[model samples]
Target: MEILKGIVLLLLVLVGFTMFSLKMPKGMKAMGALAGAATASFLVEAFHFYVGGDLFGITILRDLGAASGGMGGVAAATLVALALGSSPVYAVLIGCAVSGFGILPGFFAGYVLGFILPKMEEKIPDGIDLIAVIVIAAPLARLVAIGADPLVNATLINIGKIITQATAQSPTIMAIILGGVITVVATAPLSSMALTAMLGLTGLPMAIGALSVMGSSFMNAVFFHKIFKDKSTTIAVAVEPLTQADLISANPIPVYCTNFVGGAIAGLIVTHFGLINNAAGTATPIAGLMVMYGFNSPLKVTIAAALCAVAGLTIGFIGSLVFKNFKIKSVAEVRGTV
Candidate 1:
């Protein structure tokens, strides 16, 4: 109940900020205004922490997601989709299932169309138009649902029981393995980055992870993708808009590619150097200064995580490059997917 209240109150503040700030125009200055609004939201949340109250989502705002209603952005997206052409069931799936993570998958799926639209030539040729749209939507829908379903379901539904029972003891290896598995499983068809966040925090690793990335929803996806990588969305479509909004994607490719390298490093170093992060928030390249406070300490852990992050970034860059090389080109190419 308290968590619910905090989420609601915080959202009210966000709504006020958005209305006041939205009128400031649309370029960089508007961006600064948005940042200011986000900062205000950040302070309000911090104030909640000071009062010994839970923000219901301190990590989202405190890190970089702007605010933490957690369910609104995607709902807005679904509304837009409904207004566009989606059915009620689809809209509900998108709204309830998606969070900020929708950006990448949605963009990727849409990118297919982005590319496809140009070459389509005059009216989309009747019967093929609907077929084309459906084709584009399949990958988009799969990935979007996968990214949203788990996290949205975690504590809200009874499904987390499966994870809870498995990791009840909370061993370090279990945490790592589970983290890796959930992230991988989080791939389209049946996964959610949100569920991974809840599952990733168990007995031994709860504190360390929340401090490192798990705590902040912004950092969670950033770091997760740092490990895996995205596929469903091309960078051109997915990266531009949301990056403007300051949201990250939950695509597994980046997370897997990066985290494994970093985690492997952490795995080797965790026992020997006794790596520890006490603060509960996401630590990114910008958040590096928390060193004295013990984030990414042991140097090796930080280094490892960095290596992991770089690995994902590199892989994503390369995958994108390779695709572009093959002349796959933009969302217009086959409506954006195979």
Candidate 2:
């Protein structure tokens, strides 16, 4: 049940945001805000140990983490408000005011309110519009935040439990599914590290995730090499694919399908060998392989990582042969330079 909730939320963010952004200017800005928010959250999460400290049992760092999360919602709301023709000051103020609830809730509230406020903006007289927005939209958004709080908390708990249980009960199947999912998320604008951390994925599960991401990169490098013949671009994509979002987005069908195949293979291998990664930032090739070395023999881990790459390459090659629909655009078509 918890897993279902998590999957639903993931789909909402991925599909909902994508559909909206492609259709509206405000939606694009909202996505940008979300990306920015994810970055902020990732930084805070990645360095919590040094920046967050316990003094007098105050839990300052923890609060900072929460506040950072809220700021992401604030940023998203502010961008959407701006796109809705609200004044900069008004948008920022309302965003901060409503986002006090928390990140996920604040985002949904702001998104709902942002969407509504624009329609009403044209009806109100200019002099009173700002005040009306503040009075009406702010509280309504907060209400949404208040309403979603329980569901969000419950979803998080269920997601965590679902991941824990799946990894424990059916490691192989979970590896295939979770690996594909994690790789997909990692390649997107959002941070897989943050997602993994939020889901409390550690040990063997973490290893599976890390290797899966790397495997996707491996597949990408091969597919890209065949397309562009640029070793540099292939290497860059292997490290982190989002750097080439324009290119990757153009061929998402092939990229993702190949990634799923590669990642599932990697997941199977790592889980079968009982490999693990107990550290962050392992969701890439070098870092992920290094994480394995932290717990296992260097030679063994190196070989395993190599095999993971091979799996990705093999699957990717097969996908290229089978999927004739993969449309590769010339570098100029993507309109972005790598």
Residue-wise C-alpha lDDT for candidate 1, range 1-338, written one tens digit per residue: 33333234323433433453355222223223222222222223223331123323354334443343232334343443444345554444444434554332332222222323334424569668556545554445556556655554453223233433333343344345433433232222212222223222232232233222221222234432332244333332222213312122233344344433333333332323344432222222222213212333346555545544454344345444433333222233324354
Write down the lDDT of every candidate, Cα atoms only: 0.34, 0.65
Which segments of model 1 are wrong by more than 4 Å? 1-172, 185-193, 196-204, 207-273, 277-301, 310-338
Candidate topping lDDT: 2
- For model 2, residues 1-338, the per-residue Cα lDDT tens digits are 54454445555545654576677556655555554544555345323422342212237765764455446556655665665566677667667766655455655666677667766677889879888877887778778778876776676435655675667777776777777877876666555654564444567777888777777777877777776567777888877776777777776777777777778888888888788765443465554554566466667667777888888888877877766555677566677554
Kindly give the stretch of ten consecutive residues in candidate 2 with the minimal lDDT sum: 49-58
Q: Find the candidate with the highest TM-score and give its number.
A: 2
**For each candidate, what TM-score against the reference?**
0.31, 0.66
| Superposition error at 33 for model 1 (Å) | 23
Each prediction's number of clashing residue pairs = 28, 0
RMSD to truth, every model? 16.0, 6.0
